[model samples]
Target: MKQKLWDHQLRARELKREALRKYGSTVCVSPCGSGKGTMIADDAIGAVSKGHTVQISVYRRILVEQIAERLQLNGIRYSVQMPDLPDKPWAIRDQHADVIVSSRDTMAAILRNGGEVRRSDLHIIDECHGFETLGYQTINKAVQPRWLLGYTATPVRPDGMGLSNRVFKSMVEAAKIEELIEKGMIVPVEVYVPVKTAKRRRSGLKISANGDPIQQWMSHAYGLRTVTFCSNIAESKMVRSEFVANGIAAEHVDANTPREEREAIFTRLLLRETLVVCNVGIADVGWDFPALECVQLLTKCGSPIAYWQKTGRVARNYLDEQKSRGVLLDHSAAMAEHGWPNLSPLWELSDREPIQKRQQERFGESAPSDAKPIICNKCGRGSIGLRNCPCGNPLFRDSQEKPETAGENLSLIGDAAEFAVGKKNYQKEWTNILYMAANHPTGSKSFAWAASIFKNKFHDWPEKFSVTPTVPFDERKRSIVEVYPQFMRRREAV
Candidate 1:
């Protein structure tokens, strides 16, 4: 059966058309499982039928294979560029495939080898947010596809360096998780964390350092296939052990796990032999399984990309038909700092202006202190761990006492404190966006749920419910403060 995208995706299609009219190059920010491949395939098939060729550049070989399958399923003739695979013939030649799907390395080699991109051919850059690398630079200068379209869910880098206008000129297509949930396309997420614990318990599992949180939510995966991410290799092993001890058919795999062994585990997962599989960085990106219903986040993730990607594992509809909304078993405070997946933040990554600068210019206000997340002192990525940051660097001095436990919640410590404020202010910062969501003609119960999350964590309803009134942005901010206190004062009153 040919799949029809949800209503929002249809709107996204129109947005893509509008953006292309405005700019030659545009970033299409479609959420996961919104039929990005379907959209791409539709264009490829139309262009191919018209006798114009197209080339799709991707980061991983797996993506190339996936795109080819989508094209084939649509009955579109296409060729892949993975010569190293024994069964498939080499595809390094020029202008041969009706629709070309290849990796950056493969595409760069083709261009370096003097392969030409015909003027009518469309070049689709998959995972287009990752355009900051040298490999992408090489491909850009060498090949010129007449029509350029880049697609990604999370387009903004955590380090704050965005794709420039020279690369992705404007946002062509966009949709939010809330919109998808309202349309029953993707599963909506319910984040579970005890917001009001009695002060701080000095012992047991230290809740703040992103401690072993899987045990808290592992039960949620009962009789369901799950993918869990841990903070480190040892933690991954421990989580796998916990699940195994419970007789849940669990296993752990890491970067060192042999290819054959890893493939075997995935095969088990496919056959319903393994209930849960745990890993660190490997499971964070491009690991697609439509049956994934729950994700247990155990990492102290500082990047929005990590949070969005991890939660997105379960954002797609479950194939088993036993589940409706996706359940997020978050113990690492990942959602607290970043807010919910499929919300406005992910959609805002394409802003030509930097968020920080835009806020300063529009409102003359600096972002909340929490907006400045702790970055890895070494790699300059976001950091939340006290000792060995996720990047494996020492974030604190030896002289400084590591909290008696490895994990510390949002307090005292440097980076922890920085992120703590962000977590505390998630609702305050996103008020205007949530207000528009709650009151718009297309508004949903999601706004009420988001408000409840804010009230639970911070003990107050978000105040910006009226911010998007019939007024300009500047007056909106001023009137927002005047009307915010008028909302229900506390969760208790409700």
Candidate 2:
């Protein structure tokens, strides 16, 4: 295929080259599904032609072969120097090629063991979002490539760390989801926040019957073919189980699944044999399945960009004018809590309102008081009152308790407890609460960070006194702390 860069990609690449020329290190931030791999391949080809050795650091092995295949197709020669042949000389050492690709963890190991990268070579970090962690930073600092190029779907550090400017001299390119959607590369999505009358299960959790978080304006009547994001493997599995139990076809995949099975499931999805595919932390990149017309969020995450990325999986331009517009089945809480993607052009279309719209119009302009409980006491489900228990708990109250009602007392204490804990651990625990409440994908470090911060800042919140911080960003500067919060707060309120 002939090489051609989209307008934004061309500008991003031009900026990337200019950054490399000016500063030894630079960063490029682009939205998901924006062809990051293609851009990296093109850059490597140009650098090879200039007789420069390029070493690329990736987080996974699939990425290594993926980039290699792209470079090979571009007529650039390169070799894999993985475990099978670590002793092999550099691919560009013999003047046969100018780029080498390897996993970041591997490179870190080599460098820690006294390996050295050529001083004049270019260093590129693909999926630079992974560098938000300490281990990644240590590896990054160890394998200090003279010329650094960082690529990511988001430039902001999620762990309240100020790494935006530290990793690169400055951002060479910045493209938002809206800009991409305007170009027709991404399809606009309609968000459906299904009303959840079921009693809440946790203080901040408000997912759907499928275990996806419930948000304002969330809906599920769009039928199957929906892709929902979940908070963890447990949550995704819970979502899959609920869908399967409801007679809706569904499958779940996490980072731990076998490669062959994941591939098989992907194949089945492409063939339209499945109704829903639940994903956690794995579908962030290199995934293409155009049949996806519906996305669901079953997990909770801290990043609005991530929330959009998960939803954007189904909103990609299917290249078929006949394809129906994509549908986003949000948990009511996440919809109202994090808001939908800015790229969604649902407001622009008025030809016909879907069944969800008709139902929404009937539900009245505002959610009734009984529909918004102050707190769900039984399961620690917050903001749940006067709702029936999905499991049919006999103790369920009508949420209309009088001034001296015991249920109200219980709910208030639980709410106060959760709020107290959250406030105490706001810096660290916030991501988990956000994930649980918003139902987005996240990791353990986020939880650890929160717990440690709580222990340090509010020793009285917990039963015991202990302070052990795990995240490297705990010591970050105030500027870094400010970057993710305002965006996070906006998402939390959505």
Candidate 3:
């Protein structure tokens, strides 16, 4: 039996086909875990069925192997172009295979060695955000395929540069992150940022094993399968050591780690024998673990692309009931800078100016004001525009109570008087008010009175709340009655 593509995937394929027909080259942008591999396989299979050859180019050897596995699973004959080790009997270079998956470095080396690589009718570049690099440019120039297709979750580069009009003439975007979550294609995320820790200055070159990250994890996501992204090898190793000292099963891996050792560590994590894996740069891409529950950020990410990629690790849905939603622990306060990962920003295909210039133009010297996230004083969970924290704590607290910070300014959402109660409690309170108003002696006029009172109390319209009026009794009734006059006076003032 063949795998079926999702609705969004099918739409993306149709759009790509039209774009390719018009522009001869296009890149498809979609969120992580949005089935890019499946789409690539489907496209390659379709092209092969039409008697056209395909070449899939990737930056990493791991991606090459992963794509090869997908091709084999689909019963498609393919060849590999990677260095070292013996090749499969059927994957010989001279054999005419349906597709050829090659790493950029290996292809560059082949070109450097004065060897020729077979050009294909269609070329697919995975992680094509790096197409501006020399290796990809060289490969593109060498192959010169009739049609080009690049795929990436993020279309922008680290320096805020776009990939349109330079290499790929057009781009096809898939469903946004919020759409995927709503469609149950991916899990929702709850981000938490410490109030005090957000003020502490972090060194970019090194990370101290101060046990703060582990403490945060223990408080919020204890015993959950997590992946911690660190600044460097030394920091990752130290962080892993700290986790072990704290009696948590942890492993560390880097680019230099042997393949066998890294595979063993990953296997342990998959089996839940290891609770966390600390790494630097290795797990950013080409690694997929659906069961991962939390992504702890220990490194400050100035680039939005890197931040999104790191946070996307935990966004994938898992089968376990315990893994209902993903958790992001921002120890580095990257959330303050990059905003929530789920929000869809305007993605353009044209080239962009420097990041600093763009930021200066959009927002003065600081980060985007709209992207600022509110922190829960009680549980330290970070959210935006929610009256209640996921931990059931109220967003607004005593204004005088300041968080203990190092030396930097503390960033809070708003004053205590802004959001006085949790969303659930507010809804119930308003429902009771509406019920009382409907039964009041004023009759139809009472509903208008209640609407005015609710708007005054919550500073927003009550249309979004439940229409089924709930009556309050006992102590709740007394509280409502006491505040009723105050609500009336505020309504009268208007």
Best by lDDT: 3
Model 1: C-alpha RMSD to truth? Answer: 15.9
Q: What is the lDDT of candidate 3?
A: 0.68
lDDT of 2 by residue, 168-189 (tens): 6666554666787667666555
lDDT of 1 by residue, 1-494 (tens): 35466566677667776666577677887777677767776667756877877877777667776667677666666777655743543333334568877778777776778876333367777777777653665665555666677887767666434566767777754567677666666766555433211011111123553334444443233334677888899988988998777556788999999988988997898666886789997766666777776777767566666777778878788645534545566655554455545454524444465433442322121334344223333533233334454435665422222323234222122232333334333433344234432332332325444444444333334553332223343443333224443332221111
| TM-score of every model versus the real structure | 0.63, 0.59, 0.72
- What residue runs in model 1 are displaced by over 4 Å at the alpha carbon? 1-6, 49-51, 73-77, 85-95, 108-120, 160-164, 194-207, 210-214, 349-494
Q: Which stretches of candidate 3 lie over 4 Å from their true place?
A: 69-75, 83-94, 195-211, 320-322, 353-382, 387-404, 407-494
For model 2, what is the C-alpha lDDT against the true structure?
0.52
Candidate 2: give its CA RMSD in angstroms: 20.5
Can you rank all candidates by lDDT, best first? 3, 1, 2
lDDT string for model 3 (1-494, tens) is: 36688999999989998998999999898788788878888889888988999989887776677677777777888888877735554343435787998888888899999999888999999888888753687788788899999988878888767775878999998778878877776776656554444423211223222227776675545556789999889989998999898778899998788999998988898776898999977887656778887888888776767777888888888765434467777665565445455555456788755432443333222445443345666644444556676456776633314435433221222222222334225555465455445333333224445655565444455665544332332323333334444333212100
Against the reference, the lDDT scores of all candidates come to 0.57, 0.52, 0.68
Error of 3 at 130 (Å): 1.0
**What count of clashes does model 3 give?**
0
After TM-score superposition, the amount by which residue 203's alpha carbon in candidate 1 deviates from its true location, in angstroms, is 23
- Candidate 1 achieves a global lDDT of 0.57
